[model samples]
Target: MKSPIFSRSSSPLNSHSSISPPLTPRRTFPETIMEENIDYATTIITKWDLDGPTYRKMSSLFGDDRKEAKRFIEGVTGLRNAMHYYLKINSSSEKLIRAQRLMQVAMKRLEKEFYYILSSNRNVLDAESVSRGSTRSSLSDSLEDEVQGDEIIEDGNSISEADKASLMAMADLKSIADCMIGSGYGKECVRIYDLIRKSIIDESLYNLGVEKINPSQIQKMDWNVLEAKIKSWLQAVKIAVKNLFYGERILCDSVFSSSEKIAESCFAEISRDAAINLFGFPENFAKSKKILSPEKMFRALDLYEAISDLWPDIEMIFSYDSLSAVKCQGVASLVKLGESIRVMLTQFELAIQKDSSKSPSTGGVHPLTRYVMNYLVFLGDYSGVMSDTVADWPLNAQTPLPESYFSSPISGGSAIEDPSSAVTVRLAWLILVLLCKLDGKASLYNDVALSYLFLANNLNYVVSKVQNSNLGLLMGSEWISKHESKVKQYTGNYERMGWIKVIMSLPKNPTAEFSLQEVKEIFSLFNSGFEGTYKKQSGWVIPDRKLREEIKLSLAKKIVPSYRVFYEKHRGKIGREFGVESIVRYAPEDLNNYLSDLFFGTEVSTSTKTWSSYETSSESSLSSHRR
Candidate 1:
């Protein structure tokens, strides 16, 4: 067909040449020329008309013959261009009617092909494969080539059959979608895509165990049931963000590569509600009143951590302005989780502060000590995540802690800056609170010596727990070392207060000459003091084996040598007057043997021992001498 032309008026070469020429009113094409162009457009449109008898015999023009599919798309483009020309040339032309009918047929055909490719290649065009294929620039280039009549090959074995099929299906979908959207059939195209893909997204999430649980249902759930659900959510969220939503985005972008706005709109429409519901679960769980217990805090932190860890994926996938609510939901969940955890931590600290168990343990590890240390050890396992949760939360101590409390040698006062030190300092502070409560419990003991022993036992337990657990890493070696030294100091005080009287009862000058009367008095005093101290201490207990042995050795070293010297020096003179067995109740070897049985918590009966007989004999002999 001959193309139409437009003529423009020119200014004559005169004095007005420097001035701009008047604009020309272009003449319209003649009726004959418009008819010729419309006829030519009709021929191209009819030759590829998808509903024609010849094309119908070949089902799926895009699938059965890609080269023919390329021509059909190009023919539709030419027909659309010619229709625009005819409308401007003769808006009421009878010849333009046939081309418009052909246009409708071609669009319906392309729509059917688009639906067929998506339905038949469900596995090949799956979200994971499409997402994977979208990363390759070659996939885009290959689609362009297919639109221009290039056959895809799978010869090199570089790509799997599944990958090759995925590439071909994606290329077909992109080519057909571009044509339909470009021709203003975008709404129809987007509707079909959203229907099928939205179902896939919802089903994938369901299979991954994600559900649309409301806040009321979650609040009423038993913790055991809720915890199980939380565990399932932790597993599902990773797949939902990184795979399901991500894959849907890639498919949308690839198919609507020609229109970014349409691609974003389609993806947001298909995945927005599911994404919001998926992320909103944690926030709902966090807001539930029943989940605020200290024991449940870890699960809350777990949800916070999963969201925190997956945030980058969540942000990138929902980067579209239309999908901003999905991203906001994720962030809101994290905030809720963090708030819940902080409240529980506050409650836990209060429990420690108000612990009112007044009965003293028998020089063994107290029940409070065990409970607090065990709780802190588990809390330490989550230090990395907990640090982020509590980074801005300062310890709100009722009594301000002195700088020396954090700086104390055994406090392991290493000020770790941001993100970690908050939890470390917080845990350390809880332990300190427990120690203070224990000090009060120690006062319930009437024996000053046993009170010190109680302090030694409980402190040793605390230091040992920190040493053996993740607390060691969080609290640092300096803290462990300093507290260890404190345990030793307690044991030393107990030794002095507990056994000093026995050690002091011996004569200061053991080897000095003394008359028989003075020697008898000295021997009698030694026997009475040693028997009473040993009997009382045998009931006290130390639970740790290493500390038990160490304390025993220390007491023996201090008391044994001095007692041995005094007993030997006075035995000879006293035995000559009274008999060695009557005056000497214990040998040096007996002191070491008695110290071995000291901390077992069972009282050794002195009633059956030689010491009781000596006490009776000495008292009767003194009575007879006085008469």
Candidate 2:
């Protein structure tokens, strides 16, 4: 598609020498008088004032009369001053009143006069064209020339004079909106936008003609300057929001109460500011008297909740794709905003890590964690647009627009059809990445059981979250199954390490009668293994009940039954004077109870014999004293 602003024209404006005859250069006009008011006015208008040569051409075509040019320039200065005064004061009802009067009266009169002058010169322009025959190069050159910085004339191809007047009015309104925003009158800026949009809808700009501009044709006007100004303001807003929330201050490792509050306040402030200034929502909504009487109060929308509700509107505005006929800067800025959001979220994770390092017990649910998850959830809502923005974009393409990004009808509700699916899946993957990082932190603990316990808790929390939310669908059932397996694996790890000694102490079935010394050795090994394991793990804690039970039951299944069988068989064979209860230390039921207390700080005996010497002692004691 052709560039929206500077598409290659097939008319004389861009035709080659073979297609259009070249013409001799005409004498240029004398330098224009520098009208101070005009110069200042142009700043607000943000468009070019006609240059000396172009003004001379226009002057010549209108019988050397500069009356219309002078009037239009003076009117622009008056309009600019009025807008400036309105934006400068806090309560400028008087200024707005005057500005509105001038806009409707003085501005409309100037537009009609300017149209008259242009209309009067049409016949002279046509006569000149006929005399020049096919030598159209002069006309093309004039159209190509930049008058003031950004202004241009489009040769014989121009919109209706009424359209031009309306466009110029919009340009002035845009400047006022900018000044209002800069002066911290965000609400006033919104008001100005509302006013301008209302005027457009009412077709009030066409005071000179009864014909109104088609809403569809509003883009024909040069809105690039106005859009650029508004977009730059929004970009600054986004930057301020980023710095306020995720800057070095929030990333600091301080543990003060105020320090934590700083993060919370930053989030609230940014969310509010972005909603009002960047996304253009009102500060507060008015409620009906009846509703207010019943409740006595009303709650404002939550920033995150409001974002979720309004994201489709936001996406529609920011994800605009340029076409051959329309161009918007919204897409570029939106991509930049998304990138910043992603970076800020990453920094939040880093802060959590830093905090956890200082206090390992800082593993509870945190506001930062909640906010990150909320953002990820919000991203899921628009992941379709995001996925297309990143992947469907062509490499090094000349045009700024990606083809049919959100508008494409070829989607099948898959990742390709719904880019949001990919983004949702990516967020799920990010959660896993976070779990892995937390797992690495867990491994730093000295107690192997405690480390495994920490890992199990984190993985379980993540899987539960995915299961309860749309994240599960995006990640698919398989993803949940995979993480569930990880949770089980961590549980197994804790049980295996915590019960290894007890597991190895189980005695085999006795084939012959054993001596009293043999019974004493076997019981001593059980005493040492169970006592040592219990002592080491007594202070360890697994806060998750379900996981703790799973670990306990698993250890029981491995060692308890074996110990019970070995004890029953050997009870009669040993013939020891000491009771079997004293030798065995733990009955099968007792072992089960001990296993249940594995993670609840269970008590351990003070004295524990070493199992390593049990083998040597069995033989030596058997030789010295037999039953």
Give the winner by lDDT.
Answer: 1
C-alpha lDDT of all candidate models, in order: 0.77, 0.43
Runs off by more than 4 Å, candidate 2: 1-339, 349-417, 508-514, 573-582, 601-627
lDDT of 1 by residue, 374-425 (tens): 7677778778778888888877676576744542233333445446778877
| Candidate 2 lDDT tens digits, 152-250 | 234645544443333332223233333333333435334333332233222321221223222233234344432333334333433333332122122
Positional deviation of residue 140's Cα in model 1 after best superposition, in angstroms: 3.0
TM-score of each: 0.80, 0.41
How close to the true structure is residue 286 of candidate 2, measured as C-alpha lDDT? 15
lDDT of 2 at 251: 19
